[model samples]
Every structure is written in structure tokens, then in C-alpha cells.
Target chain A: MTAALEFREIDVSFGGTFALHKVSVGVHEGGWLGVVGPNGAGKSTLLRTVAGAVRYGGSVLVDGEAIDGRSQRERARLVSYVPQRPVYPQGMAVFDYVLLGRTPYLGTLASESHEDIEDVWEALEALRLTDFAGRDVATLSGGETQRVSLARVLAQRAPIVVLDEATASLDVAAQHSVLELIDRLRAERGMTVISAIHDLTAAAQFCERIALIDDGRVVAEGTPGEVLTESLLGEVFEPSIRVIDVDGSTVIVSLRVEEDPS
Target chain B: MNAGRPSSTRLRWWWVGGAALVLAGSLVAGVMVGPIRIPPIEILGTLINKAPFVTIDTAISDRTEAILWEIRMPRVVLAVLVGSMLSAAGAGYQGVFRNPLADPYLLGAGAGAGLGATIAIAYGPATSGWFIDPLPLAAFVGAIGGVALAYLLGYTVRSGRTAVTLILAGVAVAAFLTAIQTFLQQRQSETLREVYGWILGSLNTAGWEEVELVAPYVLVCLFAIFIGRRLLDVLAVGDTEAGTLGVRPGRIRLVIVVFATLGTAAVVSVSGLIGFVGIIVPHTVRLLTSSSYRVVVPLSILLGGAFLVLADIVARVAMTPAEIPIGVVTAMIGAPFFAVILRTSKAVVS
Candidate 1:
């Protein structure tokens, strides 16, 4: 079967510096692919290419069609991206911000119809954000803001979802809850998800497949058991680490050496 | 469960209705409170008499009728046209840049018009032609040219945020044009009074001819901008996010700039360089009404018209016999109001 989303030899550069170097990956339909890497690992850049926010060489295919030649609006319908930092204009209401997701379906002069507003309300309700719909976006806590961002993507109603370290700023509980929400929603909607998650244990716990990247290149791509091995992680990441399976769930722990008392 | 919802659409219509009434009141006051102080009854009668298939016997004298028809009516209409044009354009600029302080003049349109008027006053045909005056034409051309130059230069920067680069380019272009205008004024010191009068701005010479000149451009441009107001709300989220949401930010910005520049150039050609209406009106709309462009753009248009007509009335009455420049009146009110907004606005970057 054709992959739901495919990145074939994607190369993105800013000026003379390369952000992504001939990167390639794919996610099957209704599957979750978690991308894990250190900072500046080209994860955001890769997601941005899928979002059509940046120009990239090579092709990104959605349902076997190359998206590179598609207009921004057309690409928007195929894939929705939740950026690491979502800009919330002061005084902008949460409802209004999320309604912007319907922009792809709107004509230039068209206002949001009843159905559009209904969709927005549904997204807000699903995210348990109906109470905060009228609140100023800037006034929201970080965790709430991330949920708001996800609500907006849900409102977008695209077939594919890409999130770039969306939960990086949240506390552990918030991160788990948010990811759990996304996991449930994705399954219910039968949507393809490619999320760049910093937490390896969370990635292992949630994602069916994991792709580990380092220095703009994918170092490992397989199931959690295949890619989350200590030898593979130790070579790519600093210090030492151990991957243990307890009750059929993977947990990763970093090994930090203590200084000797002289 | 729907908490804190502003209900922007319903609230917008309410403010729009209120602003329309204010505009009506301002128009009446603008015409009735001028130098001659025609009675409201006479003014109403004369206005009704002129409407299609309606002729009413009125107490208005021939002189009063002439003043109302030939002078005040045209002047008031021109004020509405110019005021709404500037404010709508200002809201457009502010939204596209995602900066509250951005004004219609931020793109050098005012500076370019000023320079053009200065050039026309300092060096022009000595004998007046029966047909056209060169000054307004020159000013119109200069305003569009200035914006074009700014856009071209801004396009070259390509790296950082385009909005910031465009504003910087406008600043550089405005400075260069103003310097040339200053040099021209100094070279022909005899024309200083005429140049200064024009720079200070006025609706003094407004007549049916001037009203006819700018109305179409203002109407068409305003319609285009109003239709695109929702896109401006999308733009408030910043360019990259807007792009992800299926809006081509550059395309929207260009459409707005072109229409706004065209409208502003038309109005400025006839009315000269009226400052502060652009910044003051839109910001006021945001402060009092909804911050969304859906509300701000339309409210700004109506309230901007009222604000300027009232300002023009003060210009005519504040220092009787020697009328103050309308621009001076706006600046006097606008500067302090601007300061107040700056202190109170939550959106300001610290």
C-alpha cells in the first residue's frame, strides 16, 4: 500500500547553511510516527517543509501525490502542522484563533459560516476548552496554550497532522495528558501523525514506530525495541543511557556520572 | 459552557450603527457650525429640496444657499471621503504589519505627497491654465511613486521579517524625499508660505470639483479593503502561521498596499497631508470596539469620518477669521490621544 505521507530525499537550506540534508521518511495511513532527536536536529525544519512554510528541494507526497507543486491552500487541506511556538495576538479570543483553521475552505471575502463555527466549537469541546473559548489567548497557561494549538489543528480537519515539539514546554503531567488526547483523537479519526517528541520514554510509550535523527540525518528508523537500544542511543546522544522493558513497556534512563570526593 | 465570548459579529454591528449616527451628527454640525452658522432648519430644508423629485419652499437666502451648496456641502463630503480612506488604509497597514502603531503614512505616502506639493509650489508654470492645476496631480504621482520605491527596496532585503524591512525602507525613502523637499523650500524661500500652508494640511479649497475627483477611488478602494478585512485577522497571527493557514501573506499585503496607496494618493492630492487620522481613528476603534479587523476596519471608516469633520469644524472656529490648519487641529488632539493609547494598550511590545 502507498504510504499516507512520504518525504523523499528532502533537502532544506537557509542561505548557504543546510537545515535538513537529503532526509527521507514515511508514515503509513492511521499510524503514529514519533521523531526523537536533540536540539537543532532538523526536526522542525522537516515539519516546516511538510507544512509548506518553507521552500524545500525534493518531494513530499501525500496519498501518493507530490505536494511540492500544490498551492499553500491545497497543501493546507492535506496536512496541518502545529508549530513549536504559536503566535497568539494579544486580545485575540481562543474561538477566533481556532476558527482561522477553516481558512483553507473559505473564499477571500467569505466570513465563517454556521457550520465553520460549529466545527470550531466541536474542536474546542473535544479539547475541553469550551469554557476558555472567549478568553484572550495570551492569558492562557503554557499547557492550555498547547491544547489550544492542538484544538486549532483539529479544527483544520486535515488527513495528516504534524506537530513539532508541541509538548516541549509543558510539565510531565501536561505532556502525557496532551499526548494521550492526541493519541485518542488520532485513533478515532483514523489520522496519520508525525510528531517530533523530545521525550524518548513518551515516544516509546505512545508511538508504534520511532525514527531517531542526529545532525540533519535519520540515524535509526524502526520499532521502539529496535531503535531505543542503549548502544544506538549512546552513540548519538551525550553521556550513557539504558532502555529497559518493564511489563512490556519501554523506559529510558540517562546515566550521569558523579564526581569523586577527594 | 461558552465563557468570555465577545460575540464580535453582533457587537461590531452595534458599534457600526452607533458610529453611523455619530457621523450623521458630525455632518450636520460640520455644515451648520461653520463661519456663517446657517440654521439647522434651513440646512435640512435645502438638503431635502435638492433630493430627487423633492422641492420644498425654504427660508434660506441666496447667499446661504450658495455657501451651503458651493462650499460647505462639498467640503463635508470631501472630509468624509478622505477621513474614511485614511483610517481604513491605516487599519490595513496596522494589521498587515501586526503592529498597532503602523499608520497609512508608514509607507511614505504622506512624505511623498508633501514633497510633491513642495516641488509644485516652488517650481511650476507661472501662468495658470484654464483646465488643470499641476499641484494635486504631482502630489498624487509622488505618493504612489514613494510607496512603489519602498516596496521595491523592501523586496530586496528578503531575509528577516518582510514587514519590518518594508517599514524601514519606507522610513529611508520618506527621509530622502523630505530632505529634497526641504532643499527645494530653501532654494525658493518666496514660496515658503504657500508650501507651509499646504504641509499643515486643509480642506479650505474643497468644492464639488475636488469631491468628484477623489470619491470613486475612495469608494472602490474601501470596498476592496473591507472585503479583505477577515484576511487581516488571519495576518495578525504572524506571516508563517498565516501561510500555514492557507493565506499567502505577501499577496494579501500587496493587494492591501496597492489599493490603500491608490486611495490615499487620491485623497492626499486634493486635501494635502492630513496626519494622525490614520493612526488615531483605527487605534481608537480597537480601544473602544473589537480589536478584530472585522470591527476595527468598518468602525474606523465611520468614526474616522466623524472625527475629521468635527476637527475641520474646530479648524474653522477655533481662531475665527484666520482658520487654523486642519492637520494642526488633528495633531493637537491626536498626539495626546496617541500617548494615552500607548500607555493603555496591552499589545505594545515592552
Candidate 2:
């Protein structure tokens, strides 16, 4: 079978500046690929290019076919995307907002049916958000709101899910819970995930393979043991970091640099 | 999106029913409570008599018949049509632009129509009859012209048709057109009175021809808008979200803007730039119902018509003999009510 997702020489620019270089990556069916990069390193841009949220050069294909060739409905059914920072449609209640994921199934003139409505509730329940269904989206706490965003993507029921910094804003415990939940969901449902994460340790712990990006280029890509080495991360990140194994879980420890007077 | 979860489907139906009842009451009062007194039953009998098979012995007189058919009936119909068109278009504009403050008059249609009317009053024959209603015709052409200009300028300057750019372009175009209209008003004394009166807005000269001018466009636009209501909800989240939802936000915005502009131009061409109805009616509908366009669009039509008709009645009776402008009444009432709604409703602010 073909790889579930592929990016071959994807290049994206805004105005005159490049957001991503000629980047290429792919994930196997039902596999998780974590993307880690410093700020402005084009990690989010790579995911956005695959999501078709940004104009890009070259091909980003799903299941061996170019995505741009597909209709909006087809692409929506094939892949779901969650932006890092979502501006929730103000005044929309959580239930109704999540229910928008059923757009692919709905005819232009028709509202949601019983099945679609049931699926929205199911998504809300899965996210532990059933209680907040009637709440205005603007009033949600950061974690709850992020879960709601994830719930919307969940309701899409797509095979491939891409999240850009899905847990960046959560507390440490909340982040672990969200990562754990995503892992459990993927294991149970056989979902293929490509997440752009800011946390190197979490990416090392959760993802089977990690791609480290720098300045719009994929600088290092392999298993965490191979890619998350001190020398590679030290050069790319401002803070020197060490990656070590503790109880079979990967941990990244930051080292302070001596101050130098200019 | 889920029925009754947010919308309370059954209660929503009750809301619709309630609005229809209000509209019926308004229509009845609109006809019966005019300058000449007529009973409600006789008015109903006169309306029913138009049908081939149905005839009632409500003892309708020729004077009452003429008053109902010739005078009140046409004006009320025009009021409903104009009200429904403006309010529906307003809801559509708000959804497409994803802004609560958006109005039907946002795209320079008000200014364009006013300038068009001003020119006709100053230069065209002032005593023109319904057959050659030069003022409304000129207003229609001018409104279309203004919107077209704004769209072109917005498209060019913004580099893409961003909502903010379009609104900015509209503001600039409207201001420029308003300046020209003011200059023309100052140049001619006769033009001053006509332009000032038209600016205030009135239904004093409403007739079948005005109704005919507005009905076809409103019906078509309203049908088109209602069919595409779900797109509005999708678009509310912005273009990227809309695209992921299997919608082309750009195409949807263009379709909605065109349909709404056509309906708005049609009505404002005849109604002489009636203010506040478009903003207040749709705002009120969203305040009462869920913001889903499926509910808001239809309800706006009913409630907007009823609201405007009631306002017009106030305009008629508030200072009788010398009529208060319908636009003044709508603003005086709508502004305060809308302010109260805005201050109290946190949802609207969001």
C-alpha cells in the first residue's frame, strides 16, 4: 500500500519571504510523525502546506495522489487539520461549532441529520466536553478550548490528522493528559498523526519518529535516539539541552549557558 | 448544529409562529388603522373578494374598497417587501463578512442611491409619475454603480478581496459620494429640500409600481440566500476553516455579496435609503434565535417586516398631517433598542 501522506519538495512563501524550503517528508499508514523546530523554523508551515491552508509549490499528496487535485469535500474526508492558535467563531456554542465537522456529509441546503448530531455528541463526549456543549466557545478555558478544537477535528472522522502545537498552551499535567489521550485514541482507532510540536521531550516520548527543522529546512529526521542528540539540538535551539532515557521514557533537560559580555 | 442542543428546535418553531402572528397583526393594523377608519372584517372581506370563488357579505363600500386596495394595501405590501429584503440582506452581509456590525448599506449602496436620487430630483422631471419614476430608477442604477466601484477598488487595493479591505473601500467611496451629493445640494436650493426629504426616508409615495420594482429581486435573492445559509455558518470561522469544511469561502462570499447587493439595491432604490432596519432587524433576530443562518435568515424576513410596518405606523400617527420620516422613527426606536441589546447581550459583543 502507498504511504498515507507524503510531501515531495513542498515550498511555501508569503509575500516575498519563504515560509518553507523545498521540504520533503512522508509517513507510513497509521504511523505518528512528530515535527520539532525552533520558532520561525517553518514547522507549522509544513503542516499547513500539507493541510492545503497555504499556497505552496510542488506536491503534497495523500495516499499517493496530489491533494490539490481533490475536491474540498474529498480532502476534508481524507485529512483533518487543527491550527496551533484557533480563533473560535465567536458566539458559536461548542456543540454547534464542533458540529461543523459534518459539513462534508451535508448537502448545501440541508442542516445536520440525526446521525451527524449523534456524531457531534460522541466527539464532545470523547473530549470530556459534554458538559461544556452549551457554553459559548469564547468562554472556554485554554485546555478545554483546545480539546474542543481537537473535538472538531475528531468529528471530521478523517483517517489522517495533523495538529500544529496542539498542546503548547496547556499546563504540564494537561499537556501530558492531552498527549496520552491522543496516543490512546490513535492506538484504538488506528489514526495516522502528524503533529507539529514545540516540546522536544513530549515529541520524543510520544512519536515513533521525529523530524527536527531549522530555518525552513528539515535538519535532522530519525528516531528520537538518533535525532534528539545534544549536538544537533544544541545548535538549533538557543538553550543547550540533553536528552536522556529515564524508566524507558525520554526526558530532555535544558542546560544554562554562561553569560558572555558583548 | 445539533437540533435542540443549541437551537431548541421546537421552541424555534414557536418563535417563528410568534413572529408570523406579529406580522399578521401588523398587516391587519397597517390596513385598518390608516387615515380613514375601516373595520378589520371589512378589510378581510375586501382582500378575499379579489379571489374568483370567495365572496363575503361583510358590506364593503366602494370608498373603503378603494382605500384598502388603492391606498393602504400597496404601501403595506411595499413596506413588507422592503423590510424583508433589507433585513435578510443584512443577515447575509453579517454572516459573509463575519461581523455583527455589518449592514446592507455597508457597501456604499446608501450613498450611491442617495446621490442617484439627488441628481434625478435636481435635473430630471420632478413631477414624474409612476410610469416613469425617474428617481427610483436613477437610485437603482446609482446603487449598483456604487457597489461595483467599491468592489473593484477593494479588489485592487487589498490585493485580495479581504473583508476589511472591502469595508474600507466602501467607507471611502461612500464618503466621496456623500461629499459630491452635499456639493450638489448646496448649489441648488430646490435640490436641497428634495435631497433632505429623501435623506430622511418616507413611504408617503409608495404604490404598486414601487412594490413591483422590489418584489421579484427580493424573492430571488432571499431564495438564493436561504439555500446557501449553511455556508454562512461555515464562513463564520474564517476562510481556512471554511475551506477545511469543504467550502470555498471566496466563492461563497462572492455569491452572497452579489445576491444581497441586488436585493438591497432593489429596495433602497425605491425606499430612499431607509436606515437602521437592516441592522436592527437582523441583530434582533440573532439575539432571539440561534445565530445559525438557517433560523436567522427566515425569521429576519418575518420580524423585519413586522418591525418596519409597526415603525411606519408610528411614523404615520406620531405627528399626523405632517408625516414624520419613517427612517427617523426606525432610527429613534432601533438605535436605543439595539444599544440596550448590545450592552446586555454578551453573545452579540462576541
List CA RMSD, all candidates: 2.2, 2.3
* Candidate 2 local Cα displacement, residue A89, angstroms: 2.3
Residues A87-121 of candidate 2 have per-residue lDDT tens digits of: 78766789878888888878877877878878888
Q: What is the TM-score of chain A alone in each candidate?
A: 0.96, 0.94
**For all the models shown, what interface RMSD does each have?**
2.6, 2.1
Maximum-DockQ candidate? 2
**Off by more than 4 A, model 2:** A260-262, B1-11, B126-131, B342-347
In model 1, residue pairs whose N, Cα or C atoms come closer than 3 Å (at least 3 residues apart or on different chains), thus clashing, are: none
Recovery fraction of native interface contacts for candidate 1: 0.59
Stretches of candidate 1 exceeding 4 Å from the true structure:
A246-248, A259-262, B1-11, B158-161, B337-350
**C-alpha lDDT of candidate 2 relative to the true structure:** 0.84
Evaluate model 1: give its lDDT. 0.88
As for candidate 1, its interface RMSD to one decimal place is 2.6
Q: What TM-score does prediction 2 earn?
A: 0.95
lDDT per residue as tens, model 1, B100-215: 77888888898899899988888887537626888999899989999999999999886854888999999999999899999999999999999999988899999999999999
